[model samples]
Target chain A: MSSSLAQQKADKVYRDFGLELEISNRTFFNDGIYSGQKNNYLSASIQPEYYLEWSGGEQSFKAVGFFRWDQHDNRRTHFDVRELYWQRVKGATEVSVGVKKVFWGKTESVHLVDIINQTDAVESFDGEQKLGEFMVHFSQFTKIGTFDVFVMPYFRKRVFPGREGRLRPGSEDGLVIDSRDFSFESNAEEWRPSLAFRWSHYVGVLDFGLSYFNGVGREPVINDLSTFNALYGTIQQAGLDAQLTTGAALWKVEAIYRQNEFQDILALAAGIEYTFGNVKNTGIDIGLLAEYLYDDRDNIALSGLQSDVFTGVRLAFNDTQDTQLLLGGIFDVERTTQLYFIEAERRIGSSFSGAVEARFFENVDPSEFTYVLRQDSFLQFSLTKYF
Target chain B: MKVLTITFVLLSAVVTFGAAQTPEEKGLNVAVKATKADEGFVSSVVDLKMILRNRQGQESERFLQNKTYELTEDGDKSMVVFNSPKDVKGTATLTYTHKIGSDDQWLYLPSIKRVKRISSSNKSGPFMGSEFAYEDLSSDEVEKYKYKYLQEISLNGDKVDIVEQYPVDPKSGYKKRIAHYNKDKGYRLEKVEFFDRKGEKLKTLTYSGYKQYLDKHWRADKFFMVNHQTGKETELFFNNYTFKTGLSEDDFNQNSLIRASR
Candidate 1:
């Protein structure tokens, strides 16, 4: 036996742990249209993770915890168990049980087929953050493809930003939705069981996933606009996400069809990203991205990305610090609404990294959902230290 | 006398032309011998420490673990999991190299628990901001390149044979590479010089501290690469290499990337 393996056998212990601390601040260019709204906000977050593996790497346990303290907006200051699961791998099949997060999507502009976990909207505006869902997961790998089955016993409600927050969903009268008054169409409410099945495979240059989900819908439906009453409807959704990689270009598409209480909704987000490596021999790579987003509900769509175009430019410095920048804009197809954003980040030192992000809302029409936040353009800065 | 001279000349010409091997055949023979000498290592796990230095001599370090699985039919499969530069900790990349086609690669971002299919055409781009490109780190299958034997010379007091290779991939950034193989060390690779697309010297890589494992295969524990055009350098230190670790194709797939531990 190798010395390292011999030493590992003697010790019989394998573990990994890390801690991260982040401090962030955001400043608005204009005051909020609502009353008693702050122009600036500061927040801090702490995240720690622990992992242990044994039995020849067949069985393992992992736990990741997150806590955030915001200077304003108590709804944004919360804690969550991002991942706490025990997994076992035996031959071609694997099983896991506990709270975990799963992400599924292929587009850059918007995510239409990603489900399973509730979005943590109060934490970030990008919709990438999610709360863990309790489930029993089974995965099998075969010659043709990989199959995954999930049985979630409980549902986690999607949270929204507070009234004083910048990006909350608002009405024409500047009234924010009160999630406290939310209702569920299912008799079991939050205790409703959710089931999902997905088959993913790669053939040649194309990688694709087809999935079906049944249970409570992730998006809240507004039954009464005046009272801002939100309802969670039990629905069924079928999703398809695929990407074709050809040379320096990647073509991606995500489509979803949902049968909800009010009606059936069809949505899609398709895009292409082409990268030019080592442009002009400067060791910098530049990528051009463009996408189209469509929703059948149009103006009444909850997410408000209906019939839009997204274009972006990504720059990778290819330096030791791993510096990167992305500039993007989303344009409404039939309206004057437009959103422009820029994000830049780089490593500070051995363990620290910093990022700057800014979003601009311009020429928003009253009919569009983003009109309420026309003056909510803001810039944010954040620094994180990892251990 | 004139007829005898003509016969002698004709005989010598036929003997030389029929018996001697061309430079291409000699190069292929060397490559085949080297490949044969290092076969039968089914799998391995190793730790790598990368040190990157700039023109100003500032240094940054990164640590990672690598697992490799060899396939008899196709090229090898490798998985790399980052352990340090903690912000990107637990991020992993999986690659399946093929002998004739473009390689398949996937990147797993631990923060989002997402696996993304990446374009392999970016093989010329620097890996982890190091001097080594993605193509440099991929499994070097003999079929990927066309080789020609150059000459034999003395390097570091040992006899060495120089071979020139031309990449078969159309998207390759390098025009050619000159590799030096140590003749006395089981035909192991010793040094390489890269030429850019414009046929200019781009970088030089030197391997040292070679140690034999399994009583047959030789592995270099250190590699230093210096970029001539950019005045940047990178050093890789390999440690704790163990062979036949029982890794399979399952350990080099997308699922493995997601579950890869630090």
Candidate 2:
């Protein structure tokens, strides 16, 4: 099968094929301030993407695969498929079924209520956090507004044993709550769907949109039926999302104020960005973003009932020399701890880019916390080359 | 002494005649008149195709299309259709402009199966990531810019006239602009140099391949602009020049922007 596939690809390449690859080295240095040990961590990732367009744009297919290896304090290696999807669009409707980046928000950095793709840093800490999911989406154009809806039947589940222990599937060492862990197998019959509406008027200037999605939050796991019934008394089953964009600013806010099923989450985010140039000119641009998340849950273990506030600013500078610079920072404020991060990126050329980032975290009462240390700082450097 | 007095009066009359028509005033009048005439001619519906090229003269993208434009004395309407690049096929954009206030716009994307309404204040932003802002594509009527005749200049070996224009929009990114127009082509603009708010040269737009359509109407087939600081360039090619489609204000309505096609 591999040889036949290779032969067909070779034949297609002779006709017309495009191939792109990216390799990067990422390293993180920590003074062991929080971990109580200095650590140097290195990770390398290789991503190869292939595009094949056949017969005058009739049938085209694109496939992208990613592989990564991490060398940390403990030698553990893992690799996963990032994106593998095929798309076919006939006229006003298009369909894609596979693992893909299902973006569903209008904000720049923070998606106030978007639940499609799991976030990066938040997902990285947990092995069960998967970015893409298996789903089928359909989009249609209309005179009043455009409509987009997707059906996700399978969800990636995170199996967390407890707050201090590692997450392992089918483990009973610690108390397990379904509200914190996402399981696709438990609710396989339940289908999650999302809808988006867009409307525009005037010299292509003004645009507005509203979106809706079902609950994609983690389901609660109740060992006893009475406990499940008690928790189920006050769960709201639906989530609400909406966004608006004018020429000057793009704004979006989302909230998941569901009462019962187990997770009570309310997240709100707003972002504003402005571009100065025409489609042809590469010039200076500025963007400002701010986001806040409030999660209220009873009987859940991780971070026990927490509210996080995030604010960030991004500045982009692009010149005709194929040189670009992006400088930004994000400040995360919680009740007991405050985290600040600043990052800058410079594009050397079309195929290469580098970035440096610094992160600092401070705990107010360090002496009271025994499990996790406070006052930590980490620096990271990365160089990426795109083929 | 009587002859000298008569000669001085005659000389003074000649000087006053010339002074009555200063070069700056004449240039402003010509610029305004040309803009008004152009706007009047392009007020109705027109079918156009644009070809974009890069600085290296390679065709970066080609838009094979037809567009319907409806304009009023104080407002304008436009609907654009994309016929190339199968990924963006069946995409239609509808825009409405108000003379005294902000305009409203909408875009229908086939892939997303949704129509998105765009806000007006973003008119100064680049269209589709191009250097041309949404306002740049609107009708360039006399009122859009305040004019000042700079000087007489020569372009493309033709003796031309130059005028400066400052955008009336308070939020405009450009401080001022210099335009070179062809005298014989109904004062049609040949090129323009845009200056930043700091009064430094930012970009230059050149119009070429001027074709005379409908005898009295002159149109440029190619519009190219280059950003001096950034090497990026954008070119627009106009083709299938069809005029007078008998379209009325009703045709430029929101419903028509999504459904109408030439």
Predicted structure with the largest lDDT when compared to the true one: 1
Off by over 4 Å in 1: A1-12, A171-174, B1-17
lDDT of 1: 0.88
What value of lDDT does candidate 2 attain over all alpha carbons?
0.51
lDDT of 1 by residue, A1-387 (tens): 578875664456579888999999999999887765689999999999999988767888999999999888788988999999999987678899999989898998887788989888888777889998899999998888889999998988888777777777665566777666688999999899999999999998999999999998888876655556778889899999999999999999999999987878999999899999988777799999999999887656556577899999999998889999999999999888899999999999999999999999999877766776788899999999999
Model 1, B47-163: lDDT tens per residue?
Answer: 999999999999999999988898868889999999988888989998888989899889998888889999999888898899999899888888888889999999879899899
Give the number of the best model, judged by TM-score: 1
Angstrom error at residue B202, model 2: 6.5
Can you give the TM-score per candidate against the true fold? 0.95, 0.61
DockQ of each: 0.60, 0.13
Docking tier of model 2: it is: incorrect
